[model samples]
Target chain A: MGKPTGFLEFHRELPANRTPSERVSDWEEIHVHVPTDTLKRQGARCMDCGTPYCHTGKLIGGMASGCPINNLIPDWNDLIFRGQWKEAAVRLHQTNNFPEFTGRVCPAPCEGSCTLGLNDDPVTIKSIECSIADHAFEEGWIVPDTPGTRTGKRVAVVGSGPAGLAAASQLNHAGHTVTVFERADRVGGLLMYGIPNMKLPKSMVERRVRLMANAGIRFVTGVEVGRDITAKSLLSDWDAVVLCCGAAQARDLAIEGRNLSGIHLAMEFLHANTKSLLDSSLADGAYISASGKSVVVIGGGDTGTDCVGTALRHRARNVTQLEILPKPPASRAPDNPWPQWPKVYKLDYGQEEAAALQGADPRAYSIQTKRFVGDESGQVREVHTIDIEWKKSPDGRMHIVELPGTERVFPAELVLLALGFVGPEKKGLVHELGLKLDERGNVVTDGEKMTSVAGVFAAGDMVRGQSLVVWAIHEGRKAARGVDRYLMYGQSYLP
Target chain B: MSDAIWTAGEVPHVLFVGDESGCRDELTAALGAGWAIQPANDGIHAMDLLKHPNRPASIVVVLDLSMPVLEGFGFEKARRADSELSHIPVVLVTSHAADERVKKFGARAYVKRPIVVGDLAAVVRELGEG
Candidate 1:
């Protein structure tokens, strides 16, 4: 909007990334930073459309196509283009508490729904947004805003992921004494452990945590409510308790040899790998190492791709990825039009790395693992697989049918199961709390995002199943509003 | 099976177990003729082949985590329990990337399905060198 013809003058461009070959050799980020001058041009590309669909945060085609938090994209873009970076940061922070995290790891549905992308490429809103927030950090502009006055009310935020962080930040800003409880050794649940450093660096998470700490948000790591501390005790101690614990349970493969040695969950590998790297500079054998072994990754999704990339860095003997679904079309299908989330196939960074190293993409589509084969010593040695065909059953539900005579064997010294998660772990915490679960096993909540129990609220992956980080932040912000309204008007303000 | 160079000398001999023909064909093509290719129809046959005296001395074994007769974790447990095959390095491959059960089993390497021929060969070479 700053420049009337800016969109016409400049094309959309993203920061250059390290070549797949070079990036696969180490556990460093693949993207390289673009210069401020170039970033400014990208920011200027925002047309400041009258009806900016990018910020609507609506559901289209059963998928979120815009910013879930409804980030003020045009406002921040204009501010950034005008060189008012400090103002841009403030504008970005108005809606999103952690733009830096989203800017790095988010899939950017906002860009997908961008009006600019209707015909041409979308404006580089995400990159510009990230740059503005990162620049603010560098300039020390993102200082903690301690509440001037303290409200008598105290709030307890369970879980320290994006949702918990947002709830705590908002509650603190509202002058409530907010304390965040995290079960992990460190705060930033998924941000700290679930996601690898190469993607969302732990330093970024720590930097934000430090700021939140200065803002009167007390983050109590290793303190799990409902277990270490009782939910009843927390309710008695605080004016309100918000449950933001994310979904921590991984979906399992219940095939024949599920209990075999050498088969592992993707999160187990990723979490341990990150913990080891953080703890001992990669000296400890705490992480699952793919070095000097043939590796097979199951489930072709972001997690699987991450495993592929991580294994390549470890110099594994070989890598193979299997997916049950049929291969996606190279381009968007007729059903998937513009402004809808494209259901097309694209190589992610990890796949690119695997392809570069092995001279081919490491994905097998329409394949299903039948069982795990063990060696004489009871260690997993091979996997039995069969081809599957999708068919519509009499009930009209899609089901997979194993093809005839398509079975084969593949060697796998190590198997990292990258299957998706089921729901939040319902063990010590959830069981003790006695929270009601939905049909899908997620924490059940009403229209107010509050659980059946009074004075208690739920949000993020704990309420939803395993989901994107962006959605978690969105739910967290909404849940904070719900908690605030609940405290003041005895009802939720979330729409 | 094609008249290609089997660089078995430089490349590690690995037995691939699974029922997907495409994956096996792709791996054979990717590893090229340099490495010895042994395919097993099911877990039982794979185990039998591993115990056979004529079987090539493979330092590394690439196995799928899910299979019949003995699949994934079952095969790994069986292999580790046996005094003969416990020492061989094993890799578990599957389509489920983040299954915690696989991680709990302690596979040396966890490979996702839809094997990239080149990446598989590179990993195999690295294991051989190790």
Candidate 2:
């Protein structure tokens, strides 16, 4: 519920972004602060549609159509419109463990299904949510809620990504002694490494981790559970264990010249860049630099976009992104209706920067990389490609048809493969714990998020495939409830 | 009653220039049955089609902005410099934001990609009729 006629009264407005030309030169966040008045107007755009789909958080057409964690969007919108900033933060934190993270990196599927978006632009829900969270922190409203009493139950959470952190925080709040184990030296896994600083600043992540620590949640970094201590010891030691180790097995492009030196996986590039940037402000000689080199990024998802953006910041001479599929339609097609995530073409932040600097969008669709050609010194010199057509066969399934005589080559000194991850690696933790895995190679769990082995639970990318931070948070909260009930005689108070 | 027979040169045609064949094929099918669609890989190939002596009675040229060789603006510049080709209307399609810079290219019409089929067809028809 919002101003009764807010939809008609105020148009949706978001904070302005720093110019692409300017942002590419620095690693600072791109968005500028929007005045309080402008944000309140944005909040007014939320409609009191009898059935709001923005909070449904369902999977429609195989993509998220709304807030995955079921954030009480309309309630917060009404609160913010009334200038109830403190109350808005309270409502936001009630559902979302970390609104700050989602605010920055989330694609805002909630806006996609917003009733106002049916005819006009949607409410600036993501920005409003982020602002409220940030305001709460600035006002000293957010602090460690150290539980009054501790339940002697000890819970060991493997990995320190969104999922692990959420589980550790919630379980700690429920009075369980929680210790999170992270392999990386830093506590925040993907937040610290997977995501670049330009998108979600590491400072914000460190601040949240500090708050979580203050809440009595113990974080152990540079110590991988299965590798350092062994999964057997973890199961025997802790009352309950939650495996939040993400699907880090990146899918590879196993073609010719795959072993070339210049070709690197997307995560290896992003992780090292962030690490070096934080360690010495990149003064240390580390990270895969794209400076003065022709960079070619393969794949066309958010990860690929991140690679493009990072390469630009490195001052790559030129960047080209290749996508195997055809570009999406400019508008939603018949099969993709509203309330379903709109599969339409968009110029993301990276592509926008690329277009601004290179004078054209860097992405080339309907093309497939045939091979990577190496030079005399065994460095990737060129990327061989050919045009492809997606045609429907007699079986009613689409297939790729390569066009002959359409061979082309893109000069490349640096190539980043952002093809995405396949599944959770089943080598160490899952293997040693004797936990069951699904066909997709993800750890299997029951409705309660309990794995095959008793006292062992899994969530996030470990159970689900690599997904958004919002979904990971949702899974983590659910698993906490499962762990709580198991320890509390079939009852849980950790919603 | 005499039946009217038509030759390839007599049929109305649209010179489709762009590297993405998917967009070209989708638009070809959407325009539905009146005109001939000539495919060109880039602005250079598009020029070859425009300069052909036996070219069809072409009414319009639809091209993608970010092409491999001779992009839409480059093609527009070359077309405007040539008197014979300058008369043909040009339409630009792009995935990026259509700003003042895109408008300044002097295209008769520009459509953002994930293109709206009906909207593009309507623009093409209006330009052809004029």
lDDT: which candidate is best? 2
Candidate 1 CAPRI assessment class: incorrect
Interface RMSD of each: 29.9, 35.7
Q: What is the lDDT of residue A382 in candidate 1?
A: 91
User: What docking tier does model 2 reach?
Assistant: incorrect
Candidate 1 Cα lDDT to native: 0.81
| Candidate 2: stretches off by over 4 Å | B1-130
Report how far off residue A6 is in candidate 1 (Å): 2.7
Residue A262 in model 1: shift from native, Å?
1.1
Task: Put down candidate 1 lDDT per residue, A323-365, tens digits, no spaces.
Answer: 9999999866888876777677878888888888888999999
Number of the top candidate by TM-score? Answer: 2
Q: Which stretches of candidate 1 lie over 4 Å from their true place?
A: A490-495, B1-130
lDDT of 2 by residue, A245-326 (tens): 9999999999999998899999999999999999998999699899999999999999999999999999999999999999
Write down the lDDT of every candidate, Cα atoms only: 0.81, 0.88
